[model samples]
Target: MTDLSLYIHIPFCQRKCPYCDFNTYAGCEADYSRFIRALNQDILYEGHTRHHPRVPTLFLGGGTPTILKREQLDIIFEAVDHGFALLPHAEISSEANPGAVDQSRFETLRRLGVNRLSMGVQSFDEDELQFLGRIHSTGDAIRAMTLARKVGFENINLDLMFGMPQQTPAIFQHTLLRAIDLAPEHLSLYNLVVESGTPLATWVAKGQVSEPDPDLAADLYELACELLQQAGYHHYEISNWARGPLQYDGLPHYACHHNLVYWRNQSYLGLGPGAHSSVEPHRWSAVRPVGAYIKSVEEGVSARGYEERISKELAMAETMMLGLRLVEVGVDRQMFQKRFGLDAVDAYADELSSLQDRELVSIDAKRLRLTPRAKLLGNEVFAAFLPE
Candidate 1:
C-alpha cells in the first residue's frame, strides 16, 4: 500500500462558532477522557488492520485541538507513534487556537513532535473577530505566534478569514499586512463560507445579516494575491500562500504536505468522528456523534458512517478538479498518464477542448492548468470535468 497521510479529528471546542459547521462540539468536556481513549483505540485498530502503513504526515484538526491539555495531547502522540510508523521527517501539524495559550503550551507541542503549528487567527479586526465568534483578539493572535517562535516552532501557518459583513478593501488589507509582517512560514487566507445549518446561514435566511457579497469576496481575494506576491509569498494554492522559491519534493517547501496528499488525489486515512478517508477506489467517513464513534470502536466495529467505492471515471474527473486548485502547480500530465494509463489530455479531450474554447483552461505537453481568469472562476472550470 502507498504511504498515506493521517488526519485525526479532535471534536471538542470551548464554544461553537455561529458561522461554523464542522463536526466539533462544545460542552463535551465530560467526554474528553473517554473520547481520547477511544481515539487511540481507533488508531491502533487501523495500524494493526492495515499492517502499519507508513505515515508521511499527520494533521491534528478540530473544533480546537489546542483546547486539550498537554498531557492529553501527549498520550495521543504516543498512541500514534505506536500504532503507525511516522517517517522521521514527517510533517506533524496541529491546529491551535490563538487564545488562552501560553509559551509553555507551545513548548509542550514541540516536545510532542508537532513541528508545525497552524494558528486559527481568523481576523485582526476586533469587530470582525467578534462577529466570527473567535475566542482570541488580534493581540492574542500576535502574542501566541510570538510565543510559539520563542518556543522554537519554525514552521507556522496563520489562518485568516476574509469577506465578512461590513468588511472593506481597507479593513481586509490591514489584516493581510499584519499577517505578512509576522513572516510565518505559511498562510491560509480563506473566504468566509456560510454552510447550511449554521447560524450564519439561518441569519442570512431570516435577513438578519446580509449575505457575504461575492463581488467583495473576489476583490479581497485579488487584493490578497497582489499583496502576498509583492511580500515574497508564493501563491501555491487557492487560499494558501507560503514563503517560497524554497522547494520540498519539487513543490513549495512550506506548502502543506498533508493537504498536498489530498490535492494530488492520493491515499489517506482519517481517524476520529466525522473524518473522511480516501484510499483510492474506496472512500469512507466515520460517524459524527462522539458517543457513537467511541462505542463502535470499543465494540471492535468500524466507526464508518458511510462508505463507497468510486468509479474510475469519477475518480479521473475528481483528479482534474482537485489538481487545478494548486494555482501554481496544476495537474501533471505525465503523472496522470502513469496513474490512469491515459494522459489527462486524451482522457478528457472533449472536455479540455471545451474549456480551452472558453479560455478557462490551458493544456500543453507537460501539464494542464487553469488560466488566470479561471483562478477566479475555478468552480466553472472544475465543473467541466464532472462525470456526467
Candidate 2:
C-alpha cells in the first residue's frame, strides 16, 4: 500500500483574508479549547480505525495554524504522536502567519519537531499587503522570516501572490525580488483568484475592485519563471519552485512531500472541520461547521458530510489529471499499469493522441507528461481525460 499522508486543519484566523474562502473563522478563540479536544478525539479515532498507518508527511493547514496557543498546539501534537506511528523522518509542516508568530511561538514549533515551516507572506510591499487585507506589514514579514531562521528552521517556504487590481509589472517585480533575496528553501507563486462569495469577489462584482487580468497574470507568471529559474530554483510544479540538494527521484530537496502526496493521487486521511479523506475504496469530506463537527466526533458518530465509494474509472481519470500536475514526475506508465491492471497508454490512447496532436501532452516509454504550453491551458487538457 502507498504510504498514507495526514492533513490537520486549523480553523481559526486573526483576520480573514478577503480573497480566501477556506473554512476558517475569526474571533472563535472561545472555542479554542473545545476545538482542540475534539480535534484530538478525531485524530485518535481515525488513527485507531485506520490501524495506525505509518504517516510520512503531516501538514497543519487552515484559517491560521499559528493562531493557537503553545499549549493548545502541544496538546494537538501529543494526540497525533499517540495516535499515529509517524515515520522516523516525517516531514512535519505547518502554515504560519507573519504577525502571529513570535519568539515563543517559533520556539514551540521547533521544539515540536516541525522541521518545515511555510509562511504566508503574500507580498513584501506594504501597499499590496494592505490592499489584500493582510494583517502583516512588510516589516512584520521580514521579522518573522528572520526569527524563524534564528530559531534554526532550515527548510522554509514563502508564498507570493500577484496579478491583483492596479498591480503593475514593477510592483510585482519588487515583491518577487525581495522574496528571492530572503531565499526560502521553496516558493509558491499564486495568481490572485476571485473565488465566488469571497470579499474580493464581492468587491469585483460591485466594481470596487477589478477582476484579475488573465493576460497580465500570464505575463507575471512567465516573469516569475524567468527570475526564479535564474536564481537556481527548479520549477517543480506549475506554481511551486524549490532549490537545494537533490532528493529522491530527482525532486528538489525542499519539494513539498505532503502536497506531492495529493499530486500523486495517493491515500491521505484528514482530521478537522471541513477536512477530506481519500482512502482505498472511498472518498469523503467532513462537515464544515466547527460546532457540528465537534458534536459528531464526540458522539462517536460519523463526522463525514459526504461520502462516496470511488469507482475504478473515476480513480483512473483522476490519476491522469493529478499526476500531470507534477512538471517533472508525470504519470509513470509502469506504476499505472501495476495499480489499475492496464497500461495508461492502452486506457487513454485516444485522449493521448488528441492531446499530443494539439501539442498539450507528451507520452514517452516511461511516463505521460504535460508539455510546457499545457501549463496555461491545463484545465482544457485535463478535461479531455474525463469520461463523457
Candidate 3:
C-alpha cells in the first residue's frame, strides 16, 4: 500500500484576519455539525475509491480548527479513524489559534491522538498583534503556549510572521527573541505577503497602509537565520527551524512531515472544501464555497471541481523547484533520475549554468542547493526552472 499524507481543512474561524485570503468563513451562525457530516461522507467515499489505507501523517489545517467545539472535532476524528488505517505512530498535527485553545482543549486533543500542535501566534508584541488584526493578544499567546506545555504537548510549533506594515528590524528582533525564549520544538517564520484580494491589499492601494519593505524583510530574515542557528535550531526548510529530535522516527531533527510531503513532491490526499490534492502528475482542487462542497458531497458527487494532469516535463521542473526548498537536503540527484528517467543536470543545463553564473545555485555531485544569496532571491532561481 502506498503511504500518503492527509490534509483536512477546517474553513471556520472566530474572526478572519484582513491579511488572509484563504477560503475561510468567520461567523457564529454557520452550521458546523452539518459540515462535519459532509466531511465524513467525503472521507468515506475517498477511502473506498482510493484503496490506499496507510497514512504516514495527518494534518488538520484551517482558519481555526480549534474554534470547533470538542464534539465536532470528535466526529471528524471518528471519520478519519473509520476511513483510514492511521499508522500507529503517525504525526497527527492540528493548527490552532492561540486565543481559541485552552488547557482542557489541549488535553482533549491529546486524548484524541493529536501528537503535534501548531499555534498561530503571529507575534509576541501587543502592538504588532493589533496592527495585524490578530484576535489574540500577546498575553493570550503566552498563556496558550504555557497551557500547551502543561497539558503534555511537547511537540509544539509556533507560526510567526514578519514584514508587516510599521515593522522594523528592531521590532522584529524583539519578537524573535521573545519567541525563542518560549522554546517550542519547531518554528515557522514566514514573511507576510499582501495577497491581492485581501483587505490588506485594499488598505495598501488606498494609502491607508504602507507596504512592507523588501530590503528590510531580507535583513530581518538574515538576522533570524543567524539567531535561530545560534539557538541550536536546524534550518531544515526555507522557513522552518526545528530544535530537538522528535518523538516519531527518532530522527535527530524535527520537521513538519505533512508539509514535507509537499516539498518532496509526494502523493497526498486533501479533504474538505478548497483543499488541493496532487497524486503525482495529476492534481485537483475541491470547490471553494463551503455550501457548494457540502451539497456536492451529499448528492454523491466528487467535491473536486477542477483537475489537471501535469505533463512530465512540468513535473520535473516542479520537482527541482520544490526540492530545492529544503535547505540541507537539496535535490537528490539519484532520486530525481529514478523518477524522471533523465539527468537533472543535462535536462536543465542552460538554466543551471545561468543560475550558477549568478551565484544563485550550487550543484555538487549528490544534490543541487540554493546558496546563501539564493535563499534571499529564491523566486529568481525557481523561475529559471520554468519552461521558457
Candidate 4:
C-alpha cells in the first residue's frame, strides 16, 4: 500500500540539442522496440521486488516520449499497467518535444490515460530557438500547443529556459509573455546551465559563444518571480510555477507531484537507461549506455549500475536542502524532528544563523525558508547544508 511514484525514461530523440547532456541518443530510434522490451523487464523486476502494486503518479520523461508511434507507446504503457496497478486518480504525465507533437498522437496519449503533457518549448522566438539548436520554430511550437489544447489536454506544462547567449532581458520577457498567453497549467522557468562536454560548452570555450552573465541571470530570475506571481501563479519551487489554487490533499498544492517525490525525499522507482531510483537509504542508477542497459535487463540482470546507502546525517542534510526549495512550505520543524529525532533549527543552528545574519535565510517556530533575496543565491545557501 505504499504510495509509489514511477518514472520511465525515453532516451530517444530526433536530435540532441547543443546544450543538452541528458542520456539520450539521436538517430537510434529504430531500435525503440528493443528498448521498450528492456524497459518493461526493468519495471517488472522493480514491481516484483518492491511488491508495491499501486502507483500514485507516473511520469514518462526524456528525449521526447512522444517520438514513439502511438502503438509503440501503447506497448510501454501496457507493460506498466500489467506490472503495477495505477491508482484511480494517479497523475500520468508524459514529456513531449514540440516538433514531434501531432494532434492525433496527443489524442491517443490522452486515450491511453495520460492526464498531463509537458512540452519542451524552450523558446517561442525564432532566433532564440535557432540559437538553442532546436528543430522546432515558433510557429511549430504555437501549433503544437493549439493542437494539444484542442485534443482535450487541460493540464499542460511548458518547459522554458532563459539566460541564453545574446538574449536580452527584453527578449526573455517577451518569451515569457508569449508563453503566458498560451496559458499552460504549469511553467518550468530554468536558467541555462552550460554543462561540460556539451556542444555549447565547446562554443563557449572556443569563443564562438559568450556565456550568460550570472548576475544578469539572477536579475532575469527575479523578474520571473515578479511577473509569474502577478499573473496569479504560485512560485512553488525554485524553477516551477503553477496556476493558483489547485487542490491536493485539501492544500493549495500546484507543484508537480512526481518531482515533489524527489524534492521531499520520498521513495520512487526509475526505469530505463540512465534513470535513477531511491527507496530510503538505498539509491541506484541504471547503466548509462542504452545497449548495456538493454543487454543487462534482457539477460535478467539488475539494470542498476551504481548504488549507494545514504547515511542518516547526509539524508537529513539532503532533506533540508531540498525541502527549502519549496518557497512556501520550506522545511517543517515538526516533520524534521520526527524524522531525524533532532530539531532542524537546532541541528543546523550555526549554518542557519550564518545565513540569517546575511539575510539569506529565515526561520520561525514552524518552518525554515529562504528569504526573497536569497532565492537567487540558493546555491550558496544549499552548499552550506552539505554534510561536512
Candidate 5:
C-alpha cells in the first residue's frame, strides 16, 4: 500500500503579519467553526478512495492552528479519526505561534495525540520581531518553548528567519545564539523573501525599507550552517538541521511529512480552504475563499477550483527537481532509467558534466547529488530540469 499524507489548513489568526500572504483571516472566529465543519466533510469525501492507505503523517498548518480552541480541535480530530485510518505511531503535527500558546493549551494538544509542535519563532530580537510585524515578543517565544517542554513535548521544531530589513550579521548571529540556547530538537533557518504583494515589498518599493544585500544574506546563511554544524546539528536539507539520531527517532521523523510526500512524489489529500492535493496524474486545489468552500461543502459539492492530469514527462521532471532537495535522496541512475525508460546520465550528459566541472554536483557509480556549495544555488541547479 502506498503511504499517504494529510494536510489540514486552519485559516484563522488573531492578526495577519505584514510579511505573510497565506490564506488567513484576522479575527474570524465564526468562519473558523464553519471551515472546520467543511473540512470534516471534505476528508470523508476523499476517504472513499481505496488506492491510498492510512496516512502516516497528519499536518495541521495555517494562519495559526493554535488559535483554535481545544473543543474545536477535539471535534476536528474525532471527525478525522472516523474518516481516515491513522497509524498507531503516526506523526501528528500542528503549527503554532508563540503568542497563541499556553501551558493548558499545550497539555490539551498532547492529550489529543499531537506528537509534534512547530513553533514560529522567526527572530529572537525584539526589534527584529517588530520589524517583521510579528505579534509576539522575544520573551513570549522563550516562554512558549518552556511551556512546550513542561507540557511534555519531546519533539519541537523552531522556525527561524534571517536577512530581514535593517538586519546585520551581528544581529542575525545574536538571534541564532538565542535559538541555540533554547536547544530545539529541529531548526529551520529561512532567508527572508519579500513577496511582491506583501507590505515589506511595498516598503522596499517606496524606499522606506531596504532588504539585506544578497551577498550579505548568503554570508549569514553560511555562518548559520557552520554554527549549527558545530553545535552538533546535521545540515540534512538546505535549510533544515537536526541533532543526532534523536533527529529521526519520533515525530521529527515525520516533520512536515506532507511536504516530504511532495518531495518524494507521493500522494496526499489536502482539506480546507485554499488547500491543495495530488494523486498520481491528478492535482487539485480548493477554493481560496472561506465562505465559498464552506458553502460548497455544505451543499455536498466539490470545492476544487481547478484540476488537471499531469503528463508522465512532467511528473518525472517534477520528481527530479523535488527529490534533489534532500541530501541523502540523491538521483539514482537506475531508478531514473526505470521510470522514464531513458538513461539520465547520458540524456543530460552535457549539463551534468558542466555542473560537475563547476563543483556544483558530484556523481558516484549510481547516484548524482548536489555538493555543499551547490545547495546555496539550488534554484539554478533545479532550473536545469526545466525544458527549454
Candidate 6:
C-alpha cells in the first residue's frame, strides 16, 4: 500500500508579515471554531477506508498554528484522532511563530501529541526582523528556542531566510553563528522570493528596497552550506539540513515524509481554506477566501474552487523534477524504465550529457544525482526536466 500523509492548514495569524503572500487572515477567531467542526465533517464525509488509512505524518502548517489557543488545538487534535487512525509513532509537527509560544503552551502541545516543533525564527538580527515585519523581537526568538528545550522538545527545526533586502555577508554570518549556538536538530535555509503584491515587492518597485545582489546571495548560500556542514548537519536536500540519523527512518530518508508525498506524486487530503491536494490524477484546492470557505462548510459542502486531472506525461516530468531535489533519491535507471516504460538516460540523453559535461550531475552504473557544485544551481538542473 502507498504510504499517506495529512496536511492541516490553519489560515489565521495574529498579524500578517509584509513579505508573506500565504492565504491568511487576521481576526478570524469566530470562524475558526466552525472551521474545525467543518474540517471533521469533511474528513468523515470523505470516509476513511483501510486501503488509504490515516497518515503517518500529520503536519499542522500555517500562517502560525501556534496562534490557536490550547483549547482550540485540543479540539482539532481530538477531531484528528477520531477521524483517522493515527500511528503510535506518527510525526506530528506544528509550525510556530516565536512570539506565539511559551513554556506552558509548549508543554500543553507536547502532552497533546505534537512530537515536533518547527519554529519561525527567520533571523537573529533585530533590524532584519523588523525589515521582515516579524511580530517577535530577536530576544523572543532566542527565548522560544530555550523554552522549547526546557519543555522537553527533542526534535526542533528552525526556519531561517537569507538574501533579504540589503543583507550583507557579515550580517548573515553573524546570524549563522548565533543559529549554530542554538543548535536545533534541523534547519531550513531559503533565499527570499519576493512575490508580487507583497510589501517588499512594492518597495522594490518604488526603488525603496533592493534584494541582496545575486553574487552576494550565492556567496552567503555557499557559506551557510559550509558552516552547517562543519557543525555536523547533513545537507540532505537543497535547503534542509539535519543532525544525526533520519528521524522518520521508515519514511523517505532525505525528503520529509509529509512533503515527500507531494514530491513523489502520492495522494493526500488538505483541510482548511486555500489548502491544495492531489489525489492521483486530479489536483484540487479549497477556495482561498476564508469567508467563502466557512460559508461552504457551514452549508455542508466542500469549498473546492478548482480541479484538474494531470496528464501522465506531466506527472512523469514532475516526478523527475521533484525526485531530483533529494541528494540520495537519484533518478534510478531501472525504476524509471519500469514506471514510465522508458529509459530516463536514453530519453533525456542530450540533457544528461550536457549536465554531466558541465559537472552538474554524476551518473554511475545505476543512478543519477547532483554534484555538490550543482546543488546550488538546483533550479537550473530542474529546468532541464521541462519539455523541449
Model 1 per-residue lDDT tens digits across residues 263-312: 99999999999999999889999999999999999998889999999899
Which pairs clash in the backbone of model 3? Answer: none
Report the alpha-carbon TM-score of model 2 versus the true structure: 0.98
lDDT of 3 by residue, 218-328 (tens): 988999999998988888788998987544432225688888889888899999999999987699999999999999999987788899999998899999999888877
RMSD of each: 1.1, 1.1, 1.8, 1.4, 2.4, 2.4
TM for candidate 6 is 0.93
lDDT-wise, the better of 2 and 5 is 2
TM-score of each: 0.98, 0.98, 0.97, 0.97, 0.94, 0.93
What's the lDDT for residue 242 in model 5? 72
Among these predicted structures, which one has the highest lDDT?
Answer: 2
The deviation in Å at residue 86 for candidate 2 is 0.6
Better of 3 and 5 by TM-score: 3
Clashes in candidate 1: how many? 0
The lDDT, on a scale of 0 to 1, for candidate 1 is 0.90
lDDT, candidate 6, equals 0.81
What overall lDDT goes with each candidate model?
0.90, 0.91, 0.88, 0.88, 0.82, 0.81
Ranking by lDDT: 2, 1, 3, 4, 5, 6
With candidate 6 superimposed using the best TM-score fit, by how many Å does residue 128's alpha carbon deviate from the native? 0.2
Candidate 6 lDDT tens digits, 173-263: 9998899899888888988988899888889888898865778779999999889889978777778877776544322232355665665
lDDT of 5 by residue, 73-191 (tens): 88878877877788898888889899999998898889889988999999988998998888999999999999999999888889999988678889988988999999888898888
